[model samples]
Target: MNSHLPTEKQQKLKQLIVIFCILLITLLFAFTLLIAEPTQELSSFELDQQGQKVGSGPTEFRIHNQQLYVAVPSNGHYVIPEADLKTIRMLSDDIATRQIAVDQKHVYCGNMILKNLNPQTVRSIGDGYISDGQVSYYCSQITERNTELNVVQEVWQILLHHTGIGSKPQSYWYPHYQLETSQSPYQLTVQGTVSNGEYTYFRGKLVEQANGHTMRYLPSYSGSSDRLRESSHYTADGTHVYYKNQRVPVQDHPQLMVFDFGGGIESEFLHDRKTQNFYYQTSPFSQKYSPYHLLNKDDEHAHDPLFLSQQGIYFYHRQEQKLQRTGDNPFSQKLTQLAPDVFHNGQDTYYLGLYDKYIRSGRGTKLCYRSTVLYRLKNAPVNRWQKIAEVKYGNSRWRAATIWKNGAQYYYFDEFGQGQGFDQAVYLIKDAYALRFILNPSRSSDDIRQYAGRGILLSPQVERLAKAKYDENFCVSELWSQNE
Candidate 1:
């Protein structure tokens, strides 16, 4: 009797309660999804003692122990670790708008800070340099600052004049000048670097003995007009000329000549008009010997002028830097020219001459021309003397003065025809047939003399390829052989 069916009002209230509970549960599920954290599929990594991630991330940085690391996030999944940090400092609360952060002791850009730099006075001076009140930094290395150091004003003007406002100076260092600096720890970009009235610098290092006020780029010795040419390799500071930073002893800057005879020609030379001295610009010659005197400017002259030093008489090759002493002087008042280039010293006979060959390209292929000197002793085996090559045609004959015939080969001397006691001529032809038959028995003397009477015709290619065999030592032979 007490338990009876509920009335209509009670039943409605129960239905309402059930509906409210369902709505609350649905809202709770939606809220959980909205606040869910984004999970990235990262490679397995360890945490440092401070509970910070060990690797580098674009958004996150970590420094543990002495080594610092940067994390670059990859495709939103993992991070690659790399570091080019210079100095370390405890970071501050907020990153500056330039992404540069500052702590009490230092200023930092990402993971790096300048070494031993005071952050209070750090300011951007123009050029590819940063500066404090005292010293300047180029590529992060300290270059001594002089009182006359005035890079800031000029750079600012250049920025306003050339690059317009709001542009950075570092962007213009390399492209505007196309500087090709030598290998240096500081990554120098500016051509010839920045100079003050009293000091000059290159590749972030000071140029010794350089007068920055009058410093200028020298023209190319190879006849290039471009003074700003990166390969010109010469600069002068009013009083002296510097080649690739090394000072040339000769102080006549205006009279200094640096010539690059392309190919194997002459190993490039530096001529000093003031002293009338010629120097080899390349190594070995420049490194070892003093400027030498070249006698007989005539290329046709057969005898290499005696390289007479106070020490003794020396023998040197046309294309080599080495010199050898003959111990005894061969020249005497009685010395006689028996033939066109043949000499007789009463007891000994001498043959002296010149030959032509092609200079090689950077690819190791023949591309240019050079004249080589030929010297030898021709007392025995005259029959073996052969005319392997000759200069028959073109202005090269007179311009180079390279005539060819037969004599002893270059074997007695070194590859460069340098040594003592030239006994047998190697690969030279007798220039004058009348004198040739006097010693050579194999050839029909009558026929050679007859041919000589008619006069000989020689071609340029004949001299070029005749003595042009490249040896293992990179020396070209003085005469053409059948193997060539």
Candidate 2:
């Protein structure tokens, strides 16, 4: 400006510098604003006393209040403060009592005895309310007597008396009492006696006595061989007994008789040696065939006959050779398709087998194998479908595996693999799909091999599911019943 340069050039340079500075300041301010903006908003119901964000969305009641504020959604109340908040104390005494009362009112009370004859012997009493005026009273009288041999024989004369002003007394008494006596070195006799006031019920002095004979003392035979003679094979349910492809009668031998799909047909076979009749009951022909018995003649033929889920009875017409579905029988209902083997997770989800079609290529020709697939049922319509495994080979192959919901994951082999694999290694499925390959040595080893595995295995998620199902106790028999 002082004769160093022209006025217009200096002015132009100054103007350019001013414009660049203004542009830089503007960009810096914009960047600062972007960084200052919060990623998530504070919950509507929760707030910090210092007007700072504590938690995202509506804050839930929390144990810590030094850094985060907690809001209880139920009553729209703040449970914790941002700072200076002590213990959460989620539930008060009154709240706990109210919750317990609600649960008692709505939940089912199993096997509850309103008027128990003897509370001393009652191991468990369900939750229920008793009126203040109601009272249960039991009294028994004992008479003492001495025998000539000076063996003090005390006569027990129990008299139970109850007083419930307007209620009937509920009593369960052992009317016929028997005393065990030593007969000899090889035998013991149970002497049966009736109460003094009661009428004599025995047919003879030594009525219904079993001597310790070699044959009588011998363990009772299960008649399994007899069962085999009647029918080489039996259905999953014991109900339908069969002998040599014919129906059998199970009236006299109920133990030998099994419940075939709901009393369809009974057949009998005679054994020459024992003259013991073997019986078999054929499952009723239904539109829905048993999934467990998918390898059966009708099932192999893809007849699509209906069968009872619990009973395993099939439904088919002999003349038409066509399968029929009818609700007339108590066992099954009319349906296009039956539900797959179902296993519950103790929540809204249920693991089920779904029918799927797979193509197998043999000698340049392709054949379709109509098999079952696994699916997870959720609360929504679009339930998750989890492809667990498939039966690639073998006739009358694996049906569906049974899941054990305990502290850890366990699965039972399908009907085909039953009594085949090692007890420990025989588990059908695992929660982790990868473990299936590790357990099955026959399968090839590769990264993709993990996907080829089948059956249940131990896993943290599976353990959680098991704990949920068996919060109290679980049963192995019930799990095996699924195969039956």
Candidate 3:
């Protein structure tokens, strides 16, 4: 009835609005396609209640692929070629125990049951490594690490009870032919081997042949109380020096000579009764390594074990499994050790600038030359030493610059004159304060408060240097200034 009324006008407007909205939606959809980014396929897997994936990376000892291979548990392990991956879960939550584990045959990783390997007890050794009662696993592959001295001894005992060294002991179920592994849990070797009832294990690995009857530990020094120090362990059977069961080959070693361990200048040393070629840790030094009481053997250095080779004082260092020259400054001429590390040429004390660890002699920095030293004693380099003050009195003159170690602390003073004699001598207490004396030199010992560091005292500064005889780089006088 109202078809021809004004309501028809409203209907016409509504139709136009709907058509305009459809066009706007179409434009936005096309614009979105133009700027859309490409997306990569997402990695998907089921996780346990603890939020750990049952099989993900090598950490789980399970590889993920398009084919769903599942690990199933039993008295022994089984790898199912076709199974739902979402049903599996890792066993433990601790990241350390994230590797595949089995309880008798209930193989587990997070919440997933693994293909059973008849695991007794699985232990993780960090970095995706796992070891079970039967074998060790690494990166989902068989591997071994080096064994420690103590662990080698312990593992050998387990082998001895299970199998005979040359032959398997009478057993009910199976004859043991197992191999041992090292600490790496991956490197298994049978070299220089030893055996137990189960397998011929070096430490944790099974070897083809080794001395089965002899004990694996080092014999105590005839006079010592303990067996041996942990870091410095050495044992020998007939052919090699074994440090934690790792072979250290020796050349020119006599069969009849007895091996005796001695104190190294820095660490424990190895000595043979018949020869002077001593070993520090696993390293062997030259034959020139003289005896402790050999006074005539001045050719060898006792400290750091330096020796004369090709007319140069070469230090013996075993780096990368080889001995080579490695001294900051090997002396050019033949010198005698008058003190511990202090060498003497005629009456002169060889100056080893700051590189020389020994500075108590005052040779390099005790006004001996003209420079305060740091690091190991070395010859004072040019420009390293600068003159900061100068004073001349009668036949004696003194100069002061820089600071050198007095004892535990460092101080600056004059070599010729007393520091107290200066118009306004400034003594700095802390290392940060004395740094200014090196950067800036004042002719008249006066303190600028801005530059004067904490613990500044003028009078005691001079007296301390004079009494302690802290030297200047270049001074005509050896004694402290009398003006104090």
Task: Please report how far candidate 3 places residue 451 from its true position, in Å.
Answer: 16
Per-residue accuracy of model 1 over 368-391 as CA lDDT, tens digit each: 333333343534343343333232
Q: Give the per-residue lDDT of model 2 (tens digit) for 317-374.
A: 4334444332222222322211123333233332222132223345443322222222
How many clashes in each candidate? Answer: 18, 41, 54
How close is each model in CA RMSD to the real structure? 26.6, 31.2, 24.7
TM-score of each: 0.31, 0.18, 0.31
Off by over 4 Å in 3: 1-100, 103-117, 120-228, 232-240, 249-274, 279-312, 315-320, 325-484
Please tell me which predicted candidate would have the highest lDDT against the true structure.
1
Give the Å error, residue 283, model 3: 6.6
lDDT of 1 at 278: 56
Instruction: Give the Cα lDDT of each candidate.
Output: 0.39, 0.26, 0.35
Instruction: Please identify which of the two predictions, 1 or 2, would achieve the higher lDDT against the true structure.
Output: 1
Overall local distance difference test of candidate 2: 0.26
Residue 84 miss distance in model 1 (angstroms): 8.5
TM-score of 1: 0.31
